[model samples]
Target: MVKWSISILLIMLLNLAVTSLGNVPNFDYHAFYFIHQWLPSYCNQKGTKCCYPPTGRPAADFTIYGLWPYNDGGNSLQNCPGSSYDVAPLKAIQNMLQKDWPSLTCPQIGRKFWLHEWNKHGTCSKSVLDELAYFHAASNMKNKLNIFEALSKARIIPNNQFYQVENIKAAITQATGYRPFIFCNHDAEGNSQIWQVIFCVDKSGTKLVNCSGSPQGQCAYSTVKFPSY
Candidate 1:
């Protein structure tokens, strides 16, 4: 009788293991997108005007958009429960964020943009990185890949003329040895322009990997404009 009970317990444990193997955490993200945007095109998006952060107008380059986490199915995590936006911890890195991740939207009122990013994307990343660590990780990633400089070196100047998006990707791939995802948005004149450049990173938000689980925002063109700011 005892042996039969022991055998039943073993069978139950085996069943549990098999069930657990198929049950992946729905809340978890497999990869992160180190996303940044062309500030000029960002401001040019419909009904938007450039509103520099209190720190002043940022340089003409790709600025940090967000470090978004996504699953294998390309679903991005946002506004995770329990992680609220707080600027208190960001005091130390405020200056750095201002320069690298400044918001071009109006009523900046200090760290509001950062706050939004933290609440939306950073919160979802709490399992992998805390608030300070997440911002630092994004700033570090932005510093590592100078996308603007890479394009310039490749002679794909952003002077409001259309360039083949493939060439743009090639320039980035050649520089970083990994492909990048370029997303587009409509300029005020209804022309699709290169808006966002996304790079894939490992779960820790460090080390560039081949692109995966990153958003391809509204881009269906063979050639797109890299507009002037």
Candidate 2:
């Protein structure tokens, strides 16, 4: 009788394991945001100098904020239950994060920020199922996109001058073949600045795709600043 009960329990556990593996990959989530942040505006808004490595200031460029997973209807999820992240795998890619994805906040060069992001958003992305893949994919995507080069090729240099929102959008759209959604912030001078550029990508984390619904850019001004370092 005990053997029969144990057999039944084993079957149930196997069924559950299969359900989870199928469900996570097949979940109908829509898109990803290659969330690139403009560090100058972020630091200016925070009223602090952007943190850097001992070598000196990291490039005054768009560093990775995150690669967030978004749903079709505009809602998103966070920190999937039982999802945990470890800092060990990240050590292999530590140099890349330090240069391309450095923490711009002060006092210490830390992993807490990355941990927070993974807990908040990375945990929710089925495409990047584990810690190693999660950070590796983000680092790889940063190199793939290279926001600075894309803008530079379009003759859009970050000299703190105001550029028309449409032109900015066009530059990215032309370069990437996907219309990117822009987010803006006002500097201390109350002029609008381009703060972040968000791109929609596929579940595999490789290609740029159309966003089902773009996040609205908050810059009310016709022209927005892309500040210099």
Candidate 3:
């Protein structure tokens, strides 16, 4: 009787672990909320960890911070609440740029300005939309490429082989035109992550440094940089 009880307990524990590991959060407004609550804590911000850890081993030299908006084949703009359009992330990036180049205009910042806006709020004002259209038209003329094709070429391999250094550099170049400000990625197991830009460096290399963490301890490090994009 004692042996049977112990075996059953072990089986239950194993099953629970598998179930927890396999669960991926559904993408919705609640997804952002879940990421906000869980990611920081998982990275040891407040000494709490996630239920399912990331698969990538933590890096010793890099830090990635801030959350990159995830679009799970749905329109984020359609899902955001309120009339204001939830443009907090673009405003945040604009504020950052103003600190460096006070005279910079929205158009001068190039595709990055639009990418940041779309990534965060899922939509943009008419001016930004016009700028994006112009940028895409010009880019196609110069490179014989379209936005859809570019994005298709830029997709990352969503597997354990994610930390490919060459692929990372290529992705950064393709997305941002300039080299990455940082080089970090989302862990497969976590619902959300954050990458904060510490500061800029004047050196020939990348300008920003960031830290990344999962909603669990699966990926934890401070020096991760954003990919060139």
Predicted structure with the largest lDDT when compared to the true one: 1
lDDT of 1: 0.86
Q: For candidate 3, write residues 70-159 as lDDT tens digits.
A: 233322222232233233443534433222212112232423433443344432222223323322222222222122233336764222
Give per-model TM-scores.
0.85, 0.81, 0.21
Please list the residue runs of candidate 3 whose C-alpha ends up more than 4 Å from where it truly belongs after superposition. Answer: 1-48, 51-152, 183-229
Error of 1 at 12 (Å): 22
Candidate 3 lDDT (Cα, whole model)? 0.31
Model 1 steric clash pairs? none
By TM-score, how accurate is candidate 3? 0.21
Which regions of candidate 2 deviate over 4 angstroms?
1-28, 46-49, 108-110, 126-128, 216-218
Model 2: per-residue Cα lDDT over 1-229, one tens digit each: 9999999999999999998987773334576788888888887774566676665778766888887877777555566655676898888887788887777677545587788888887877754557677777787878887778888888888898888988888887777777877888878777789988888777777778877776655456678888898
Find the 10 residues in a row with the least total lDDT in model 2. Answer: 23-32
Q: Candidate 3's error at 3, in angstroms?
A: 98
List lDDT for all candidates, in order: 0.86, 0.77, 0.31
Name model 1 segments beyond 4 Å from true. Answer: 1-25, 214-218
